[model samples]
Target: MSENEHSCYRCGDDLPGHARAWDYLLPDPVALLSDEEQDRLIGVRTEQVVTASGVGNFIRVILPVPLDTGHTATFGVWLCVTSRPEWQAVIGAARAGGETWSGYTFSGRLATAVAPWPEVFGARATAVAPGPGLVAQIRRSDERRLARVLTQVWPDSEILAARERGHVPGVMTGDRPRWRDWWRRGRRKTH
Candidate 1:
């Protein structure tokens, strides 16, 4: 691939030959709810996961909730968007390997199991070079299915911890992506 070719944000691999003929399907945030027209979209289910197509890739999660909720639900979903090349690569490779779900720690290993949820739920997203970004909306049904699948795949404690943490590991870690820092450093040196 030529240096001019753009790569996936989550995975650093070149987007195959060119940015033509890419496929994408982002799930609607309310598709899993009983009433799709409800104005209020609170809770963990209202989230989006952005990913790239082909090879290893990472997901960019976006949350639509306040810091605190009145009550905790049985399971929670999360949205993440990373500007880091490493994370993108990690997720891309995992996807290609047919490993979907992932977690930050051993006790929070939800990433590996959840990885396949996107594909199974018809939310699998792909982006070619020079194309629009891809975002995936996971619903209650997907969560329930994923949770059920997790119980058999990973330890009970790990699965439970993932639920408590909203099925996202290191989610609250750094404030922003690493690329910002790199940009800052470069600007400072140039100045």
Candidate 2:
């Protein structure tokens, strides 16, 4: 790898040229549903949780929590425009050793298999890379499918925002991905 090459935070494989990274937000495994709704959603997959906050609201709670019905969960995605079929396998390897899902404090601690989720890098905050995290990588043509798959995983989640996004400096927190930040970065370069 050359100094110009940027390797994946998880896979350590050299990223192909022309790869475009993006971020999308999505609901946590548990959304803001009543007890009945949560049961209906995850069913038998989870156990009861105990918190020190005299019953933490985040327990089994939807991501970007507090139940933003009008908001869509976001995720980060990278479009690796490469024909190398092995890239998928390499990504899987990176994910295998990564921590994509969070809230084990509420989800219980048996330790389950790992899965990937979108994360941000560069300016603003960094997910996965702060340690090891997961994100999706796909061909440019399959972006829509990626969205569908993301939603399909959480049936009870109410989604209001879902799209490719760029992070901004001091503005792109895990809860927010301001699209205008991308343009702002370019504007700064010109000025």
Candidate 3:
């Protein structure tokens, strides 16, 4: 096989050139909320940290799913903290970097609904900080299905299906915009 070509481990079939990583801007709870409600509840927001009055404290994390193509699918997700102290502790470890960050582990519920596995939403998860300049990694989950997703290798077809679902417009399962619509809008002539 060529360097660019990859075969699936399960079926020995060619794997498509689908993206190996996906990112979510915000947790499903926040994303589902109206703009006005989000603005009213969210007190402090940043690229990695989200603090809301009634909602909860959230931290960006990474969930790695192994694919049959010997590639890992990385999902940038969010973990909800139950209290301010817990949030602060996690944040402090992340900020400290090096050993402190790498050794830190925390438990929280997943705030993001991953595509093709929206059932994993709100599942209890344990995340460990990888290191500086990297988000925490979801090491384990209480939900059986989600635990399997995290530990077992999945067929490339499954990953591809998730990618396809993520690209569809008006699809609530995957919170992604349809790029084709933007291109069509750009081509339309204005009066």
Candidate 4:
């Protein structure tokens, strides 16, 4: 894999002949939960194991019991723990229904007859991509969270004003029109 490419064990092709390492990437809500929250989300029997490597740090969370999140399935989460504080904050924020950040954790069971979902990880555009359901869930969650943030930051009036004036909204500087901004709507239809 290239330097910039994702070297995540769960998604990387380094392990030859391995169809995929994961069955389902962890849902956004589950990944963002605190350790305690994860225990509750997965169940009382959740097991956490930490491992270190040159690439990065990792934590494997094992759930033996099937829980309810609209379905019945055992979940195993793999977290890329580059930073504990950041990952904790990400999970906490997710649980609180706030920010959308990565490093939450990846979830999946082994790809076998017993597994509920396909074993996959990473974005679809990549050579080694995650399952469609997993991608959709993550994308939808992030989009919803982002939309919420944008809505709170950009009120209806600001958006309407921006649209009418042909300018981006949420700019405090733009609130006070500058002499140099006479060309805010410089684009005119050429006939």
Candidate 5:
């Protein structure tokens, strides 16, 4: 395996496989918005473009669990840069401010499988390359939690519930065990 083909023991996802370590490159216009611009979105600084290379230079944000329940899947947020200049600039700013961002404890929210999702620790930046984008993933073990989180995030969506009857309303009705089976199987497999 190449240097970056580390397996995610938690999720079983083969990230940056040995053969494709350099394949997932990302490049485009990159900029770091000020605090005001960052906060203008749904969440405050939920995402950021880092113009530097260091620990904590990137961040993954996990949404907070709602107050009613405490079991939902967590979403992921990444603060990254798509260009070398962006990374360098952010790193420079950190150094100039006498701020050491390396080794910082960054964590994201988890889907609780229902209401309030749990918290998850983020991986550290062991390597940085100007391609393949800063690929972040939800741990494989967190799949079920993530499903629940997604469901909670959209209550009326019925992602986990049975699909609407395939037959036309008031037109035709018959046993659709196949469809039912599909949903059951899918939900089970996801969980």
Candidate 6:
């Protein structure tokens, strides 16, 4: 393989390119709800904010996980806020730009589960704004596995395998894809 070409660490097959980051369209809870329920409860839905009468408010943020290959995999997840005012405060800081977000932080539960680690769903997390125009970053998590994912560098093979598994449904809706399906496909390709 050429130096610029990327390959799957698990299957030893040439990959199209480096792994790309993915974003969840909605929080797991909202996404799981039926269309009618979502329409009835959600008052305002935007790319950055989601306000629901019974479900609470959510703000989009990025959770960046470091990969061993020096590339970072980012997941566009949502953080659920307890109140409308708290949600507004985070949006304000994010838009104010410059050092306005300095020292600003908020505590909330992760609304979306990362495809690679489904256990992170609804985990308690603390987020901080990196700067203006940038989404909030998950600085800490109460869940041990999620905390490690935030702090540690993961093997490229694991990440690549996750990327492959992400194609199957239920990656974001809390229904985990079966491992056998992914393994069988990989084996088929090799043969």
Q: Which model scores highest in lDDT? A: 3
Q: Write the residue-wise lDDT of candidate 4 on 1-191 in tens digits.
A: 65343244645644332112232243322333467745543532223322222222233432222222222222343433344564465345344432232233332211111122212221111011133212111211122322232123323333234334531111112323331121122112223
TM-score of each: 0.19, 0.19, 0.75, 0.22, 0.19, 0.72
The better candidate by lDDT, 2 or 4, is 4
- Candidate of highest TM-score: 3
Residue 151, model 5: lDDT of 35
In model 6, residue pairs whose N, Cα or C atoms come closer than 3 Å (at least 3 residues apart or on different chains), thus clashing, are none
At residue 153, give the lDDT of candidate 2. 44
Of the candidates numbered 2 and 4, which has the greater TM-score value? 4
Error of 6 at 161 (Å): 2.2
Give candidate 4's total backbone clashes.
Answer: 6
Off by over 4 Å in 5: 1-9, 12-58, 67-69, 79-191
lDDT of 6 at 158: 86
For model 5 the local lDDT of residue 138 reads 32
TM-score-superior candidate, 2 or 6: 6
Model 2, span 19-105: residue lDDT tens: 322222211222223467455544223221211111111112112211223333333322211122333343344446455332111
* lDDT (C-alpha) at residue 124 in model 6: 69
CA lDDT of every candidate: 0.29, 0.27, 0.73, 0.29, 0.28, 0.70
lDDT of 3 at 162: 83
> Where is the poorest 10-residue window by lDDT in model 1?
104-113
Which 10-residue window of candidate 3 scores lowest in summed lDDT? 182-191
Model 4 TM? 0.22
lDDT per residue, candidate 5, 1-191, as tens digits?
34564555546566543211111111010122234533442122223332222211343323322222333422333433223454465445434432234322222221112212212212111222212233233322344544444334443223123122211111011332232232223222211
**Which stretches in model 1 have alpha-carbon errors above 4 Å?**
1-48, 51-76, 98-191
- Candidate 6 lDDT, 1-191, residue by residue in tens: 65646665546666556564667788766786679988898998988788766666788888989988888877788877765577788767767767887657887777776767766765668888776566778889877867988989988788778867762222332254332232222111221
